[model samples]
Target chain A: MTSGDRGIRGVDSAADDFVARRRGQASAPAAADRPGWRPTRALSRAFVVIAVASALGVLLGRVDLVILALPFIIGTAVALRSRPTALPTVTLQLGTDVGAEGGDVHARMRVANPGEVPLSTAVLRAGVSPWVRLRQGHGTYAASVGAEMGNSIVVAGRAMRWGAHFFGPVLADTYACDNLFHYETLPAEAKRVRTYPVGEPFSADEAMPRASGLGGTHRSRRPGEGGELAGVRPYQPGDRLRRIDWRVSMRARELYVNHTLSDRDAEVVLLLDVGVDAGTSGGVDGKASVLDTAVRATAAIAEHYLHRGDRVSCLEFGPRVRRLRPGTGRRHYLSTLEWLLGVRVADGVSSDTRLLRSGALPPNALVVMLTPLLDDSSLSALAGLARAGRFLVAVDTLPEHVRPEHDGVWSAHAERLWRLDRENAIGELREHGVPVVRWGGAGSLDQVLRDVTRMSASGKAMI
Target chain B: MNDSRLAQRYHQGRAWLRRTQPGAMAVRTSVYVTGFLAVVTAAAPAIGAARAAGFALVLPILPTVRPMKVWPTALIVTCVAVWALTGEHSYALAFLLGALLYTHHTSAAQAVTMRTDTYVTPEVVTGWARRTGLVLLAAAAASALVGLLPRLFGRTDAIAYGLAGLAAVVGLGGVLAWLVFRKL
Candidate 1:
């Protein structure tokens, strides 16, 4: 398979410029602050044609030709009858600024004519990103506003995919009484709509190798209150009556209490390999690309771990490493998702060892690295995490049917070679005791989590 | 020659139209038709009956050309040239040129205001048509009124003075309009 020919640097620069422009527009003054009206070329044409034609007809003594040219004279006179004292103000407002994939948003544009000469007809158009598809019959609107009155029209669209999209510089063309004199506004304000990535439903309650948090759902090996009994111990002064092992005490002729292992929460470190996104991105409805799979898998894994009362921290490594330090709660999940949207491939090799240098990986915490397994840098990062003696699992997010079918048999053979190389990488991680699992959405991580639990039972994951 | 290929190409074309201009088939068709009719109407008086039929061949090319800014001026000049050649006193020719200018201006304005992917709503088309139609009607009424007025053309010095005064008035109006329109 061919890697992406597009450099993320260009996309990043364009996105940055768009964001900066939108920011500037948001703080800009209202359209009504500046009032400018101008005559179009059509009006000038009317004037010239009427004057020249009428003069020639009269000078040449052709009464019929003179009659023919009078309409233009009348049209020009009617067009010039009105004088616009002030420019009309046009403003655009979005119904809601945030949406999910495949969700609709309505943008309302208001054109207010504060002048005495009301606009006879006004056409308003809003430019939008291709990712944000306008719904049928919602592209353009026509309205006629009276003197000192306001008129508004709604342009509705649906967010076809995830990411931040903008609908822009709403343009307006306002005509005077005879459609002669028109006023076109200098680029109106732009609106931004942030669409969050939609994730597939993932159901995985797999066990983690270790638990260290104060509260959780996994059964830990440590002795504590409020769980299944670990053993019986000699009764202490502070022991409650409910904890007394009466049968064991009778057999030993001494007072004893039951020792229970409480279910404790653990820290989950999610390392996202945002080094490269391979394959074609068919968007939401079609096949998921490598990056799409990685992102969705990261979201699903984070959601699963967070739902289990475990603190999940996400680290995306590229030229710059973005870290969401170990956090738990619905709000943290949202913040993590928002961070994932900004993750793009870096230009150079990521030499930043900040993830290991920061010592954010706590003892006994299970680390899961989501990657496409196509880039060596990401695998190297995985190897580094494993070498730190932390329990790590490599979740391969490459789609199984990623090979292009229309490229003939040679491409098929090349795909096989590439797959062999990827397998060798996975095998290398496995030889270092890092388990690899293919992401299958709902139960993708179950088997790998079970393996980690078993290895931890043998004191391998912790070592 | 293959049936499947032809069918696929046809479907692809349809899909492209739907993608670029969703739900705008009727409105866009109307614009094209109006543009062609205006051209045909303008040519009728200028070229006479037989030659004007030949002008209809240029109708197909109009949709393909980028709406040029010089279209209105060129079309008005064509009408003037036709009147100069025929010296016919037909207001119909003037009406035709006026219609062409009106539609061309509106089309260009719409193009500037919207993206190519945007849909052209029927309401916008109908609204512009109604406004332009009223202006045309008003101009026709004025033309009829002017036709009823007494003839002023003669080989006399008084007539020449009158014509000169009219030119002076027109020049002044142009200057005043320019000043007012330039304000921001």
Candidate 2:
């Protein structure tokens, strides 16, 4: 029994119902509602009034024109007819702002059916404004509503620049005007949409500071930890084989040992630019705003750092600002996800530079920013943080492929201006001694990271 | 509330609409019209023209223009066809119209059918066959009722009497639709 076919609500529950029905215990009605005498809506039936009026006018005047109007008359008459079908629930939410294409990364939405009767059908869609690219899944579903299976669907879209967007009122309808405009449809509850800001990505381009708060990285610099072995005493049972120097033992010493130090964790702070213009084209898979990229990047970096037992923090800004302080471990990761998931771009229109002041960043923290570097708001913010003597890396998610949007003669000129602005932004970042990596659409990634870091502070711009 | 009950209601609704399905109405119209012509023929040979013309209004509406299963759209076309052919009052022609209408909505083979994707999902095809089987079983009982009704009552015009048969068929059928929809 398919859950949505009055089958069952959840996939698990549908399985149970199928088993029960096969065992002669389950009983659901086999009959579906007939397509007649169904409830309809005033909006769809409004055309019926015109048809009736046409009929009345022809009857009163004895006009023979009604025959010519047969198609319209019949079409409107059909539209007026009522029909039955079930409705499902819908919901939408936006993720936090940090940096990337422009604003928030992706908009996530879900539709669920929470009703007794199986809705033979339901559809949900988002009215995404132009900008961000979808950073996630296909946002469509077709299914029935039943108990064993939840007739539910989810959608994620992008918005480049974030301000605010509203979504709601699930379009639960049974009666349709050729499946476009609907008249009768019982809604199955659930209708909500939320917004989020942009988050930043971690870039290897940023220069790491000379020191780290994490002791292990600093300890690797000490001579005693990573030096060649002098010699070793007679074998101690607890001694590691990695420390054994066999050649020294053959020369004169009984057992010599090699020395080694443990690996160190790097502290990373993703300074994301959630400005209005982040990337050239739509950011997050198309729907993702820079804010969304930043959030995801923050989560990814935080996850990466936490895995390495390193301290990681996030700073997000767009119209406004917020901070998720440096921390490590699973609890911190979850908290970070929650924080990133909840934010959207600020509405201030001006970047909040207060967060980037020298004293604001942790002492010698590794600062990696994700931005398209479209405006000073995001660029100045990162430059301020980098100037604080932190290991600064800027991950550029700007337009990698220069595509044309219009066929007008001026379009080429517009494209050049866009390229020029980007060049200026890159140059400005280089002046601050910040290591910046601009992502090419499909280039070798590790090589790019390696190349970007190989350039000394003086040889920053070869592009 | 039950599958059978729900089926009964749908049956009733469809039966009522079959006042508009081709087969039910066509069969009823055929019997009655044929008998009416017979009665008129017995009374006087000249009565045919008036009688046939008089039935024009009811012709399109009766036996559902084509057949009850053919539905609301068939009414006008069936009416026009019946009216045009009423000069002859041919049973064969009426039955043809009824077949055309019914086949328009349903057919024996999957290829000769309407509604392709939506109704023929894997799950729905299975359900449709199961439900169709039950309906055919229920229809057997309706046919039996029609066959035996004459034995219980005095002889009347077989054509006119077919109305009573059709009514019984639809009335029982309606209850069947309801029962099926509601469950037994």
RMSD to the true structure for each prediction, in A, is: 5.2, 16.8
**What docking grade does candidate 2 earn?**
incorrect
Q: Over the stretch B82-129, how does candidate 2's per-residue lDDT look in tens digits?
A: 333233323333233322322222211111111111112233233323
Count of clashes in candidate 2: 113
Residue pairs with colliding backbones in model 1 are A64-B89
Badly placed stretches (over 4 Å) of model 1 are A1-35, A120-123, A137-144, A177-179, A186-188, A250-253, A351-354, A404-410, A461-463, B1-16, B19-50, B59-64, B90-117, B120-123, B150-184
Off by over 4 Å in 2: A1-266, A277-300, A330-348, A357-360, A402-404, A440-463, B1-120, B126-184
* Candidate 2 lDDT, A1-463, residue by residue in tens: 0000110023233333433332242121111232222322222222332243234323332111122122223333343233223334445544543333344444434445443333333333233333333443222222333432443344344454332332222332221322212222222222222223333433333223333553433233322443433335665677777777788767865776655443444566766665543323243344343444445555666665565566777776565556787777788876676566445434466544566542446654666677767677777766765555545667775444434466789988998897788788778877776667754322313443353344422332331
How well does each candidate reproduce the native contacts, as fnat? 0.24, 0.00
> How good is the docking of model 1, as DockQ?
0.30
lDDT of 1 by residue, A1-463 (tens): 5553131223334444644553354322333554566555556666676666667665665545555555555555555566776778789899998887779978888888988877766767565666677775444555677778888877888886666667765766676654556776554577777777677877776778888887788788778875767899999998889999999999999999999998888899887777777676665665667767777777887888887788999887666777888888888888878776666665667643666787766867888888888777778877887777788888887787676454676876876787788889899889888889888888877888888888878875343
TM-score of chain B of 1: 0.62
